[model samples]
Target chain A: MSEFLRFVSHQIEDFAMQVTFNPVEGTGTVVYNLSLVRVEDLEQTISVFRATCEAGVSPSSLIRILYAGEELDGFVIPQNFCGILTLCSTTLDGLLLQRGIPSNPIGGGVIEVAENIPKRFTHLIKYEYTTIDPLQVLVSQEITSVHQVMKHGNGSILGNIRECHMEAEDDVEEVLDELTEGYFTGILDLGLPNTPCLGVAVDPQYMGLAALGGTNWMAALREEGISVTMQAMKGLCDISTMEFVSQL
Target chain B: MSEFLRFVSHQIEDFAMQVTFNPVEGTGTVVYNLSLVRVEDLEQTISVFRATCEAGVSPSSLIRILYAGEELDGFVIPQNFCGILTLCSTTLDGLLLQRGIPSNPIGGGVIEVAENIPKRFTHLIKYEYTTIDPLQVLVSQEITSVHQVMKHGNGSILGNIRECHMEAEDDVEEVLDELTEGYFTGILDLGLPNTPCLGVAVDPQYMGLAALGGTNWMAALREEGISVTMQAMKGLCDISTMEFVSQL
Candidate 1:
């Protein structure tokens, strides 16, 4: 009775994603892509997206894009905004890597920057994770403000992500937390554009009990010892949906 | 025991990744970022990765650098080649989506042909999926091949792939016969690039237990039926190291 079961027969691993860019600084436009790909054969299951968002001016206009969140097409920023984003790169943790200037690039490493986080736009991002496979398939999402830069101009925008946020409701988190038997964790983030860059160390392992009910790829990963996996939302922005499905 | 186990007390889905490119005909380069985000607090985890690869007329030329991999970084071409790549993209499924196409702009989509593809190169990617919590954290990557304007550069690299005859060893079709369980499918693919773009659906019930040892996440999902995700090499060209990883 699930949408996937009714439509998709081959269960390998498939994912579809879309990203829309709202250029508030340079151009008021929305840029997004909807794509799907199969993990086993690198088959492009789907690929398409739309981006709209006009360009804006000023650093505040740039930082406002952090709210784009991966799920929404676009959002408008307050015409009157005042804030300064200390733009630069600083290694937070991990090895002396490019950004991993600190041990493990995937193990708690990041780029840090602080902006005048707006009050109305400051939405709490509570993330939840589920492993689709050991190395490749996993889903971790939430509602948060994600900021990004455009290739054209020297500015950025704040993105208000609601679709992913809605997916990770308070109830969903509760279920996953109890399912994982308390190994679940929620961190308080300060970085505006928080992204996760991780490597698939092992093959993917889908978790969850189907006979019980319909659970998604993420919900199935809990039984294993995996509670939390790093997130990297940068590669996902404005890409064709096929990109995600091909990785499955 | 394992290098990551010492401080890896808490159960976590850890990861790392590398993307390399070698443009043969025209010019090809890949740009990407690595990231890490927290599951609970979406704001905490952040990371980035940026890299590029351009195929020299041969293999080694201007800036000589040595790294990993079997074949030397210099000119090395085999009789035939094959590869198995595992990646998840927003549009791997090949859904026709209308992304904001720029009017009087530079270009759109990753369909750029550099009029070339270096002799060959392959990357193996894997991720251990979590059972619950779906997160979409990503890093964008671009692979631009500057060929001889083969078809005015607007053609798709995935339009030509048909069989697995490009490998250095066994054909992928033969490998399919080796598996009795799991599902196989070929929905989309990149012909010239030698990428499959296929899918591998699994029941998880049987595969989760057998492949994951005793800790299969599928144990939790009794029967709704699930997918056991994996990737296979597409190119006939074989690299010893890559072959080992693909078998998993």
Candidate 2:
């Protein structure tokens, strides 16, 4: 009774993340997707969610705090607030190191908290863990660098390229129609392989079409010509709002 | 200057593992491939590698223990020993619980050392860490239950299935050729969707072709019909000898 596998990616709407495992019930479940437009971004997302509840929460797992649906008490983290959010797992990294605040190492990977956070309260959400074993669902690319988006603009140089495998359905639809027609004619055929690529291979049982066909395949790779600006980071709230949106 | 994506699966000779990340150098580089044929399997792989160097050894990381190429000295773990084998990140886990011997939770996932080990020193080598991002490299399956392989025969019920993905590259070669042709015609058409399966996708740039294509893809999925009893648990030393080989 142990055979599980789940993989979700940047579902959007502020944030979303997922990675579940079973490996014959050895257990592994990591989820991240935090939000807080302001209010000092809820004290640095409750001091990085109480340093992931002091690094180890797994008594089958539970660490309360959910609003709208109800269930919110004390709401502690540098002395409380109760607008009450959704996910909560008893944030307690020793009450954010007694109060100096600094705790990130939820034991896996990703979860950066970008240099002690705070760029308008970093865009939280990025979980990490790696043992390996994710098979299908491929095709998600969003590159950038036409000389750093013509020197800065388009979200100032972006990057996101995903690829998965296991193999065989007409060579996986001829390698997803030859990497989506060679990254949409290699990013606007700048001679042949320009630099604004965009690939897609969604359909893991139509995973909301890999985020709605990667947003209409990056708007058809920016209406075919490819001068698109940003949109690449993917999840953990686009890598915690990429250094405060690449420093504006 | 960061952007690394590595995925290596089961490169055997006892075991081999790899996972390198650098989302921007927040860092992630788990690796394992220990050894110690006997001498009481190096005191239970140094008491399960000193309970993963006392649950957490990342003060910016560096444990030290390498062999053959050099580095060994004190040896530590359950005191010390020196015939010196290989890879030894300075074994510590609180000096094997201050010499009592009990350490498990090498962080990540799937690495349970189960009670006092030793079913022939439980096949040592199983690296656990699950956050999931391992893409591309799937195909390795070994299932059982043809009524438990004819009432307890083929090593009595087995398990193994591998897969990884993040996306991009002709949609990662068409979702690894439609999950390797729907897990090889769903394990070999017993009416067009049999059961016994096998899939393998290990190829972090030919890390010795995941132990030579996982032993010729489990002997060609047991001569094409699929009855593979077991042989699918490729890295981290077959998941730390799966509960000492599923309790024999």
Candidate 3:
């Protein structure tokens, strides 16, 4: 029986494009391996992958483009680039109107061969697109801030609240310095003035950086006599580790 | 600004091994890319990956092995095989004691370079290992059986249950037929007489087959007047899509 199983070798002959949306930053990053993909159908293939995300939200203006380990020219979305796109809004309909792209509803589908790529390569492409929603945010907030912090330290610190907003800012900087070490660096994006929170977006190379950053940030906030509730999105699911200041 | 972004293009260059244990089948499958690993260090890398799982549960015996794309000879555990292993139990201490290997407690770590692979290749391997406890089984069973069925049909016909044990078996066979189509396939493992349940384990190539199969099997059981509840394990976290007969 084992001898007959010699014919069962399988290879991932398919290429995949994963588009992750950072709702806090209103940005989405498109990632695909160039070596595994055919150069000819790169444009249309990306368009379809983009269409999957567009089904959920529209992408407004291209922020940055990287191709084959180099940044490309112009803000105009190129046919061959496989990097990040900073959208104007997190909503699909809003982004479509902002970008002036006709909104055609493209529902979800499974892995399929590239439209124009050679059939001989037996190349397959799968698109995994997901957006951060209110429920996910609320669950993340409860987990990172309320549950995890209380588990680490007692709630008596809440009574020792000091009006040290400046000290809290310094703590934030220190936390950022620790998180940005090595290949797992992240950027901090401040929310609107009324929101009083910070959003940190990290690259996809590291999966647990967002969770780790969020935990450290929450701990730092607690240390400064400031109370903060944070919501973290995992790198595998979302584009960033977000730290929302719920209390201060 | 775009030119200065040269520091951003970082690729994964390390090798990894992922071992997933299927509790239902009493088996564990070790997956690693042959092209990305060294021939000599394959044994050590697999040991590390296995150790990660063995850190959780021990195995009783070796079932089978496959390398590259073919199955190797004997249960002697060759140095190059990369396929599946059928174990006796899910406990790590049990497996270590059974295999007579010293228990070197290596905690979880990230990706690292292969010992002899070419540096130019820059191939990256990622390990994702998780075991499903009884709670996962309960949650999966509740979701796949109750929620999905309630969504698909009105509960009116559930009261019209018949004593069709034979029919329920036939339905199980039909559901398995649908799930086993194409590259995706599964096996049904019956529980002990006292347990009164069945476990279905599907390969990792497909994600939602267990849920699909369980839903179909439950629906079939309902038609036969045999009320059955099932839980399915997804390939993302578990080795196979497993449907456990929760209640009958």
Candidate 4:
């Protein structure tokens, strides 16, 4: 509706079609962005998890993650530890190699595309959190819907979410336990550390949920007016670290 | 149980006469220090929320607040927004002021209390989200209990829950929008922001829960082994602002 998106260098595909054919927030937003991806001929979606799991990397290097591909921006690492009395959040390689079933990273809703973003890469990307247990680091961060982000000022609530994941990966578990697990019973954005090195990558990519479950969760969220996008996590897949990243 | 309480220079008086007790923490934490009030210590219990709402001073200001007398702590800077918001947390006060009325300001059953220290002053006091919507300034925050804090941090969850006032406030339109409310659907602390501030409070005062039901909610939380505290907003109330503050 606003010319601001155009001024921001974003494309405006079917404004009338959105207003006419679709009138819902989630549906409309996804259609608009999908149109952009279609016109631009950009790779719509990529299974970063599957690619990352295939790449076998080392934990110490803390670099060269599996989902290192094009159009993928970030990732959500949810690991709960039973040993070391630590908040234990290891790298992708460590997890895939040791964690539960490689395909069930999200536990309940596997095989579906991760949803939090809407149009592909635009300006910024976000990662949203739902539940995170400290005793185990068990997580419930589903990027499958735009509702989570749009409800709060576009992608405002999730902006910090991805950052905390990327930058605070090192101190995330310990600090998360201290900052969250201890006193706070309420849940909002897991207040990960606020440091330069501690941030998440938000690539403006697309993963169509239409093929997965008739609709993409992130696209649905965008229809609700959430400002978000996808990332390039599957690009780093190098085959060796495939099993290792899943267990971490 | 441990000698940790010895250094605070304060003694729990309720242990003598009534053993004021109220078990807090559904399983985690919320604003603490306020839990220092015991169930039997009606005067102090009433004063904690009174201070938070009326004075707009956090729990850290308690030592001096008590010394300054209730009136001074209750004083506001003429239409002070914080003072107004504090006063708006009057639902519980109605129940407190009118005994024999089955209602709980601190919450239904689950109460939470976190340790209170001089340092955690700014962190340990969270009022529910009442001041919003009905008044649209800040959400009305109440002296919440452990169950309420952990289950639905912002108290917005109460929008759908009418434990005491069910059927009285029931409306078809309201219930249908429950999904969009997104208030009570996820982890209380990590879900929707209750109001304006983050529900993260840390007190280094060394004060623990004294009693529950009538005792301070803080003491109740410690027994649950939660080291942190944060309470979000919930439902609505019908009481004078001051009355609500006094009761909460």
Highest lDDT scorer: 3
Query: Candidate 4's error at B169, in angstroms?
Result: 36
Candidate 4 C-alpha lDDT tens digits along B30-124: 11111112223434434443433232122211111121123322342222111112111222222212222222221111222233211111111
Off by over 4 Å in 4: A1-83, A86-90, A93-248, B1-44, B51-55, B58-231, B239-248
Greater lDDT among 3 and 4 belongs to 3
What does DockQ give for each predicted structure?
0.02, 0.02, 0.03, 0.01
Which ten residues in a row are the worst by lDDT in model 1 chain A?
Answer: A86-95
Using lDDT as the yardstick, the better of models 2 and 3 is 3
lDDT of 4 at A245: 23
RMSD of each: 24.9, 22.0, 24.7, 23.1
TM-score of each: 0.19, 0.23, 0.21, 0.20
- In angstroms, the error of model 2 at B64 is 11
lDDT of each: 0.18, 0.21, 0.22, 0.20
Clashes of each: 239, 49, 11, 133
- Residue-level lDDT of model 3, residues A1-248, one tens digit each, is 11111110011001012333333343454221111123444454344323322221111212222344443232232344344322211122222223333222111111111231111101101111111111111211211222222343211110000011232344334433543332122222322222211111112221111111112222323333332222222112222321111111
Error of model 4, residue B64, in angstroms: 24
Higher-lDDT candidate of 1 and 2: 2
